[model samples]
Target chain A: MENPPVTDFATDWDHTDPAWVHDPYPIWDDLRQRCPVAHTDRYGGAWFPATHAGVSAVAQDTEHFTSRTVVLGNGRPLEDAPPAPIGVAPPITSDPPFHTIARRLILPAFAPGPVRALEPRVRELCRRLLDDLGDATEFDAATQYAQFIPPGVIVRMLGFPEADEDMFRDFIHVVLEGVNHPVEERIEEFAPIEAYITAQIEDHRAHPRDDLTSYLLGVEVGGQPLAPEHVFGTIILVLIAGIDTTWSAIGSALWHLASHPDDLARLREDPDLMPIAIEEFLRFYAPVTMARLVKRDVEFLGCPMREDDWVLLGFPAANRDPAVFPDADRFVIDRLENRHLAFGLGIHRCAGSNLARMEMRVALEEFLARYPHVELTDPEAVTWSQGQVRGPRRLPVRVASA
Target chain B: MKVTIDAARCQGHGRCFNLAPDVFGFDELGNGVVLVASPPDDRAERLARLAQVNCPEHAIDIEE
Candidate 1:
């Protein structure tokens, strides 16, 4: 274990800060111009790669930056020590050859086939959720509509009891928001979630079903059954990975729609433009920004990063990079030649990208048809989470029931 | 237009299939599988280009 290199970092930034979460672009814009490879001693000293090229390189270079502790400033024992170290999972924390197997097991669920198969269900869910909002002209889109779809889809996929959704949501919040808690407290909070998942795994063992847990139980890696620890971790990963990530994305997109009626109407008029629009929304309001712990000493984009140091890949910043994307700040729904990194690049790209897109598309289309005149009740009041996933925590949209 | 996919580089983000379903298909493992269904018209040609450009891996190529 080598000591982290101490150096005076140029910028002082913290993701846990609400101001940063509400609007990080201005600060990121400043970083890209002044300090593309900036550093901070806040979280035991971590680097911030603000530029597109810099973040892309950091995310792709698996040899140097490892996905051990993705959460920034994830130190352990409720103290200043770096949090639990390549986490015992196969895909997210595991690198290269090992990641391939774990990713493959979950790939089919998100592939075009399964996603397409779930389309009708998605539409129905959207309609029912909208129905639940009947005669209500004023509502928070975040809770009323956007937040429900992702977790609902996951529950159906995992065969978890729908009644347990509130509990699951609570667990996910604690786990994902654990950055604010001490490592021990975080673990204590997460113990029930782990126990619940364990019971599900054991139940599936006794009565195997077609759900993800049952399937994962039988999955073999390199002809040997994947370890129980890894399976449990993967399930937890799926819960956290699936729920808020997509909801944040969908919330942001709807927020954009509320603010920009022209774009919303255009999408309604030309539904064919949706595929392109979805991509554009993802690029502009990209939700996830994950970090990787440096595995060994390596210099990235001329900045020397040492082992165990955190380097946050600001993927959303990369999408706004003018060098790669012309008119990067503006949201062009039908923008051609748009290759955005809303989902992180390389092997660790979002495992649920397809499902996310499908959910967003269904929600957007159905809402447009039912409530065509959706607009933000108070644009200034919209707030986003200041964490790995970004989305409107409270989005009040005014819609005239038609 | 003829298109090619560099199998080695493809991490299977599946944008190709999502954008241009006619041009690309998915293998069992969810990697994009180039289809024999060629771009037969201008609309398809446009989609093929969109798919190629949006590929996160830059795995697709056009040979018109």
Candidate 2:
């Protein structure tokens, strides 16, 4: 099999660069061609698997690559220490055997029944959030509409206080976007969120209900109850994964439709295209970049990967790989063979994926249903999130009926 | 029509069960457990086909 030329890049790039943050596709395209498996000193030593094949290899080969330290390079996860980091979210930060158990413990919450059962409430929440906008012509789609809907679903699902949606947004922002800040500051920002998760776990232990937290507490993994830290970690993981991930996708879909009137008209004129459009949106504006820590040194696919190396599974980049996707850049709504890795491939594939896609479909369906003709008010003012999961942070649009 | 689910490939995205619950069952972990190994009825054929198509992993296979 022919492969893209691998250019040895000792100093590849950083995620925080403005050039990368504003637009990463050009950079990703460049990497996919020149350095399919590139390395950098960024984050103390990280590897970039920028192709569909490269990413799949890393994500699928958990035996060689571990999830022990996913984000921080060459260090044990915070969950490893005593007091063991409040709400130490698992599955993502764990290796096999254990990750498998954690994954099974939480699967039912996001299964088809739960997600389908939640759809009516999701639709009602979307309707109410849209209703509050009340025909405003110019509004920040991110804050005004996109941000509110997911948190409502999350808040309702997690049994958190209904009014604390903004709190969810703020905490996630710091954790996902505040990579520029020192680890200490980021931990300080995350402390309360973990505490909140811990409190919820405690509450569920005493006042167990039908909620996810209570469910986790009641389940026995490996013939033993899950640790409080694991429970806390899982809840926090669910909250972080649930709330903002799809919010950005929904916001980007709006950005797409608002900018492209023909597509909007097509979707509006024929509602049958909504499902296809949702997948297309996920493929085109694919969000999320996850990482795995190298377990041992192995020359992988012509690249020398060392032990303790951090290899980022470029999920979004893999989605746009030209070798795998024809017209990798174009937004073809009806594309049938869309085997995209917008959700990371392999065992660690997104547990929240079903939920994210469901939310995106419903959000867009109700959105264009309410306001058919929409346009970007200030396209220049549009901004996207910087680190971890990437999407529109601020998208201003003018709706005909709002 | 015959429908087979490769457990090795099925990562439990639940797309199969989501689209056609009648044709697929779920283990406690939400992994796809095909109820009807091979379709004897036309309704099961359609349902299995839909489930196969929706699977993110393409873990489900249909044979005629």
Candidate 3:
């Protein structure tokens, strides 16, 4: 079959098109094969690099791909963005030296030990939530399981009262649904969250505790105590980065497992395979569609990216790059040489990656162990979210009676 | 294996020592300081390698 013409790319990505929002992969695949570095003037003159190498190169080379501005059509500099740290690229968006210092202060809390310590608690939380599913044959797994777990963990880590978890979740939802609302409205929506985090930081300052909030509050950068704005910004960044990506992963894994019963059976039989399975799941369903700005004018893959040009790193596309992985679409839990960049690469890799992996592993292990017979009621009924981070919005499954 | 840490690069994040305490120790400034010049066993060696990977500053280097 002949590949479609490059001009067809424009028809594929309409921001308001609900169908495109649901499944942008087909469009992305077509663009990747035909025109890897395709431009879309639809959403304020954005460029979408659909190929594996094209996007990965941009993500890895932060010097070439700066993160100073909001890539998602928000024209404000990150520092001035109202969502505070989440919108601003402090540690993640900045270059080395400053980025290195900020990241160092926060890295210890997310090291393997702390993540491992949370494993038991994450498993228990998954079990309790799944147990409540009861005789109900159909429930949105995204809302029931995936959405609840990450925020719950975040609340605990931040020392926020557990009762306020739903509020936090709602705040994230507002921030992520940037496509539907104007940038000003989106900033307004995040105001309460910013205020709340600021208050928490002040509280932590008054009574120093062992939590992450207090740790950040006490951290000194360049021999000076970190600024309150930066502290608040980092906190916001952690909340957004930690919650959405992990939830999307859990949702994607559930969908994949429920859709493929044989894989689930194999996983259930060998519990030790859970670790590799988690890695495979990430490779297959990398939830984030990252973007980076070209720091210098560069030419690659026969396309020239000028300085300040936005290059979208299609991670889902990269994970399925045939050159990197043989039979990239197939899910091989025991697949060797799996160095997928789902958590990204280089200095700006996800800080909470260890915590994310631990959470997913524990959740999946406990879930499969508790409900081995669980199966999707209607695989076709699964709905995925639109925008940068994509995952199932609704996943309906039933636990088969043993 | 010998693990070397550059305190100037280290922000005293304590992640290196947290991952492999037997090999990588921390000073009062929270900067990672090597306690064992040579890893005692295979387990120590593996932990030492993990410390290198997890170090945000890339301050720790392991020599075999």
Candidate 4:
């Protein structure tokens, strides 16, 4: 869906706008300076908090905002969707009280210990991907390398077919990037995803395996099997949330390195710098800006918000807030005092953060090790994905050696 | 100095454990726990302070 170019983002902001999609940092920076909280009548009336304080306040405030529908669309979410506290995606879409219960059930799976156990597998996947490029001098890094890493790992985790990776990418695009489509169109677009998830759940039931999908089906809360919706929601959440977000992170970090040779050289010189560089990459190119539906009409950050209003929680923007970080706009490779809200803040913080970080670190380490002398073939040719998750969709780079 | 993590504020970000492995470790749920409640030396103290400052949730507290 092509949104009309945004003239004055303060009053009429559209995240899907071409200008914002290509590069939103400037738009967010402009909004931060002019109006800390920008309101727009689009998306059935929504508010955008540009400043770190405003974003942090709304992210931490459950009373005023509802997580029922984190993804904003033209249609009112509650019209046909489930009520607050238990939305389509549990934990992420579930509000507090209930949010904790749902979160705890799956937290252990993504806990540092469990996530660390997958490092070797993730590193192997990265190596395989790099090896596949095999003596290629020029290749698309985003699609060829970065994009394949997360789907490979997630498919293995979910016990899904390796062939379904392409389909997963399509489903993510429909759910995330196709926000501006009409409600009817949106429902039609979502039909395949719904059908696919249902079929996967049924299959998992028939053939139990040591995978996350089976675990979710078997796990109980309060000594009772999880509700069908709970199991389904959590499975869908893991698949959708885990894939594109990390893929984007890996892609963006590579894109940055391809563009900035000095940073790449420094990373090559200091192997220990990978961990710090990864954090800096997350802070600078942080993808994934979540949305929240206002519970009731209330004045927040001095803005008069109405019931069911969409709050485009911009964590990516918050990461770039100058008041929060010194030289916020500049990417510091060895940034020490960094507390960027890339995974977000509060209870709804990303559950797959550990896995995401591990994938990113391994992806970069392997990529640079394989193709140390890499640069953009055509910087202008690179394309960034639109909507909440941002990253290079097509990165054309020339590698000097294998 | 005494180091601690406010369990209420710590959402298991793992920053403490990642930054200062000696002073902090993660629980089963991955939330940070003070391994050495009182930093034994200046090195541990520096690491604890580093974790405190880098914690996005501000969950770490050091009483000097």
Each candidate structure's TM-score, on Cα atoms with residue i matched to residue i, is 0.93, 0.90, 0.82, 0.98
Report the number of the highest-TM-score candidate.
Answer: 4
After best superposition, candidate 4 residue A173: deviation in angstroms? 1.0
| Candidate number of the best DockQ | 4
Please give, for residues A1-402, the per-residue lDDT of candidate 3 as tens digits.
Answer: 111223456433443346556666577666767777777544444577776677666665655666665346544334454343333646765666566677777777787667778888888888888888776766777899888999889988988778888887777777765654656777678789878887888888999998888888887766888777678777887888888889999999988888888898888888877866887888888887666766667775676667666666677877777766788877897764465668765566777877888788877877777678767888888888766777898899877545
Where does candidate 2 stray beyond 4 Å? Answer: A1-10, A72-87, B14-28, B33-58
Q: Distance from true position, residue A37, model 4, in Å?
A: 0.7
- Expressed as tens digits, the lDDT of each residue in B20-61 for candidate 2 is 667888776667898878767878788688777656577898
What does DockQ give for each predicted structure? 0.73, 0.40, 0.10, 0.80
Q: Is candidate 2 or candidate 3 better by TM-score?
A: 2
lDDT of 3 at A167: 88
Provide the lowest-lDDT 10-residue window in model 2 chain A: A1-10
Between candidates 2 and 4, the one scoring higher on DockQ is: 4
Task: Give TM-score values for chain A, per-prediction.
Answer: 0.93, 0.93, 0.91, 0.98
Give all candidate RMSDs, comma-separated.
3.8, 4.5, 5.7, 1.2
Stretch of 10 with least lDDT, candidate 3 chain A: A1-10
RMSD of candidate 1 to true structure, Å: 3.8
lDDT of 2 at B55: 66
Q: Between 2 and 3, whose lDDT is larger? A: 2
Residue A285 shift from truth in candidate 2, angstroms: 1.2
Interface RMSD of each: 1.4, 2.7, 7.2, 0.8
Task: Return the number of clashes found in candidate 1.
Answer: 3
How far in Å is the alpha carbon of A129 misplaced in model 3?
A: 1.6
| Candidate 2 docking DockQ | 0.40
